[model samples]
Target: MSTTPMFPSNLLPNEASPEWMNKGDNAWQLTAATLVGLQSVPGLVILYGSIVKKKWAVNSAFMALYAFAAVLICWVGWGYRMSFGESLVFFWGRPAVALDQKFLLEKAFVGMYPTATMVFFQFVFAAITLILIAGALLGRMNIYAWMLFVPLWLTFSYTIGAFSVWCPTGWLAKAGVIDYSGGYVIHLSSGVAGFTAAYWVGPRASADRENFPPNNIILMLAGAGLLWMGWTGFNGGDPYVVSIDASLAVLNTHVCAATSLLVWLFLDIIFFGKPSVIGAVQGMITGLVCITPAAGVVQGWAAILMGVMSGSIPWFSMMVLHKKIALLKQVDDTMAVFHTHAVAGSLGGILTGIFAEPKLNRLFYQVDDWEKYIGLAYGLNSGRTSAGFHQMGVQLGGILFIIVLNIVTTSLICLFIRLIMPLRLSDKELEVGDDVVHGEEAYSLWGDGEIFDNTKHYTEHNTAFDLEDGSSSMKKTATEVQLT
Candidate 1:
């Protein structure tokens, strides 16, 4: 027998794939989709809601909610095609929507899964990218302006990045770059765009900064929990096929995140009096971002090391550099999007070279022939002593290119929009949050259709004076205190 393993001629088509594979793939796709959906809905949604002070609760929530909706509409309409369709002159995919059931079911895909599964899986990535961008503009952006910016950015900028990185025939993919997941496309792009938008939009109101404490810590915890769990899909869905490699990818992603979380908590205990829940969430996010590019390619041990670097480096950048470096301070990345996504993404890109294993690369590449060829170029067959390092250098180059492009493009977009319409809210609106702007509050306990409370002992708090809007005749002293 030949050294190569032999199989039946008819085995070319996957026979193990029962009709249930369609069901199974879709089930996995939906499961993964919902996990990603949770990240925005209750995950980052509540995290932002609780992290910001009470005054900006509605504002933060709206930013996340709007991005979630806006990205979906754009994805199904045009953004999806631009990323995954046949390469549009190498930079993007062909412009077309995969809306019909027949097209989705019978569509041909070159990679790990069916076309339908791939479309939905990719849609989540695009959606989350917008959600991540929303973090920077959370506290102070106008609802109208944000509503407009999401589709515009998704159409002009995000699609380009997704297409460049993921489309099989795109220039970046053809150049033998391996993202595995979304280190450059999602995290790095969002991080840079977020910082640019934040700087362009300007800081929150002075009062907001003075007392921007979290409104609801419990809600924040809910959001953080979802983010932690949702990452299984974020990494796992990349492989598309429900194979051993997919399982390994998911494991690697979690291991990195867990390791990073522990490292961050330990560091916090050493430095601060106690560990903070917020700090732990930051560590979790950093770990996820760091492992994006290397999740499938690296061993679990390498993931642990990457996790440490991600958690520590980004934490230092956010905590120390933002405070110490005046230039970074001026940028006002509202939720530290740059520190978490950009810094961690860059770190992950570099580490992918250092940690990628020979075997995993082969399995992932064997899923497609073009990938097979490129895999060989960078795999164990390469004569260069430091080929992984060389591949890593390519990854770094991609990261830098993304950063510069986002900075320039996002700044220009913001400047153009500012020239036409005001980006920040008025002084009066800033003092009051969603109640005055959207005319809707997140919660209403007394569902009596009116905010009229006539109880004798009741007191209502305002930004300035506490008004005794009650039926009582007794005089009450006004206290100038900020509400927690």
Candidate 2:
């Protein structure tokens, strides 16, 4: 009886759906966030699991899975606000809880959607960044150490980059440095942090380092396919609206990726005399990272040019320069994240400054500050050369900031974690890999119902029986045992 008379017949628009909220934008933002999340969970989880050597598969995949879950808890608890909330310093924001209903239901600072949508959307980006860092540490990093590294790196390293570049009040944003999606924030930071962590964690075991190969190439490609397709949300969702710029970003993303993949495939054929699926995947990733900062702002032709540069430049860095550089050779970057993400991300930032179209920039940034947002090409054509140079300088400055920040913060984080636990796994664990580290194997060679025994299956000296003969008396050394 009380319920029947107390409430209004219909709720007002302001009560449930705020006047400022665009239903289409909110729906698209949610969908885009889910796509990005998919790239990390099953996408990266499968990729990491199948891409590593058979013995190391489980551990590698678990690292990504753990980071995804850990980053979400930290993001909503405090990471989100520290990234996009009120400024605490020029490069950081005040940390605060993002889970409150009052806060989540409010109009977001930038988008025509609720704060909850922004929080979830941004959380996926944060989670993926940590998962990317796990790539370099795959084969040998201690899982316990990674558990600590995830939350700490997100707080000290990721938030600063995000605050400096993406937040409306961010210093770089005010200075007109453009990072359309996260070439700088996610890719560059992850690349630098990963390489730094790898240096501190040390390389995988000598044997694993020398001969590690994918356990399942077909499944690795499937995960890569998910990563490639999921980028529609990665670049497309950055605009925070379902607008023409969003469509341009989605198209540009694919075009750049496809072009870069072809260029990388052809280069592999010319140089290595064979097509490599791994090389092609690296090319696709580089293309995605390279276009991220300029996807919506650059024209279609510029996207192709960017793809060509990304395909060739990062390929050279990884295949040639990594071999020549003393420091690069010393660092054990397991997945070559430094080349795929750091180099490509930097190239994208610089390219964005050179190729960003004034009209498209205006559409994305919604700013009329012609001097600040003008790309180098447009500035030269429009007789505003100084503006273009300024933009280029800003781009370089952002890159420097990110590189320095990650190098210092990541190194410090690793050192700090080292105090509590070993950054790299013990020698015994590294040699045994997934079986020893996680008490599991990626594939069981025995019958389906058999329980795996470390002593019998993975001992330093396994006894091999010559079952081909009539007698089981003949035995061979572990090295001679070939299950296949």
Candidate 3:
């Protein structure tokens, strides 16, 4: 083989090396976006598939995969502009296609990177938001209705939240609300929209709601692991440039998540008498959500403090309050996203108001005004107490805006989808599940030298029994569960 250079010797001076770009920042932004994308594709896809009952494995996983593809198409077409383009109003942006080559090659408004990179990164965030909303509607939502819901919700709901919170001209951004990544635009919005959609789509089938069990606990953990690790990008990339703030955000993100997981794990062991893996995962997620808004603005001690609360508050809401509150029980959020994401996100936003350091906020916001963004803790210590109260009020306003916006937009989207199609799966489809709905099953088994009958399939009554003892072997002959 010849040892030759990859690029041509006569390559132009400025063709690849742009006059106004930082290659490292662009590269990191792309990598960060891809990591966040992984959190949705294989990450969420695997988690949803293995976490649901065996019958719903295909449907649950497909919803995530489909949303990822659908949102990308819509995002480039018009959704992106509607989210971050010229302000149509205080709470919205004007819609336009984001697919022009001339436009994509230019420097982005907010970063030193090309507009194309910004679009791609923002699209991943938008896609994941839609995927999280799907978490609430899983198991009973009609596939066709979901297809409509994704694009419509992207237009009506997600765009509004993204525009109002993250966009430079957004009303909330102008009001000094700080959502470093997507605590408001993504998490709190998804949680509320999901719960509202669940109300309109109704619950999973009684059988599924009563007794759904994870088909593969180990596989579920693997997917959750991907999500946990993927946050390096989720919070790290929000700064749009690699700097000390990005590094600090990444460290704080992991520290908070780890602390919250341990706190929640210990809480479960003390209260329930055993450390439940599922509960620990929930805690891990809440910790991640709780710190997202303040990851860069908080110190190590603040992250730890946020973690402790994240691990407990969501647990109380999920375990005790969910039982006492009739409204929560009535909605039937299949994945409990309302508790894990909505509650945790709101908690994080409030805590961000409390613990955000003045120095870090200035670094992240690139602002010199000390009065505008001081956290309550620092404000009191520094004698700018009113500014801190103002920041906290803005935080609450952002939360209230998100909750109301999602409820209205999601309800309308559901009602509109209902006009053309039934929002819920048919009774027969609900009863039969993936086989009848998708003509496939998540798992199958064959003997050492033989294939099974075409009419039969393995199930919880079959493969689950084999795996219950933690055996590696998957012997085919167990009690049969008839498809009919």
Whole-model Cα lDDT of every candidate shown, in order: 0.76, 0.91, 0.89
Model 1, position 58: C-alpha lDDT score: 75
TM accuracy, model 3: 0.91
Instruction: Please give the lDDT score for candidate 2.
Output: 0.91
CA deviation > 4 Å runs, candidate 3: 1-13, 368-371, 448-484
TM-scores of the models, in the given order?
0.85, 0.92, 0.91
Top model by TM-score, which number? 2
RMSD each, Å? 6.1, 5.4, 6.4
User: What TM-score quantifies how close candidate 1 is to the native fold?
Assistant: 0.85
Which one is best on lDDT? 2
Kindly report which residue stretches of model 1 are placed more than 4 angstroms away from their true locations once superposed: 1-22, 111-114, 367-383, 443-484
Clashing pairs in 1: 43-223
Instruction: Give candidate 3's root-mean-square deviation (CA, Å).
Output: 6.4
After TM-score superposition, the amount by which residue 72's alpha carbon in candidate 3 deviates from its true location, in angstroms, is: 0.1
CA shift of 138, model 3, Å: 1.5
Stretches of candidate 2 exceeding 4 Å from the true structure: 1-14, 368-371, 449-451, 455-484
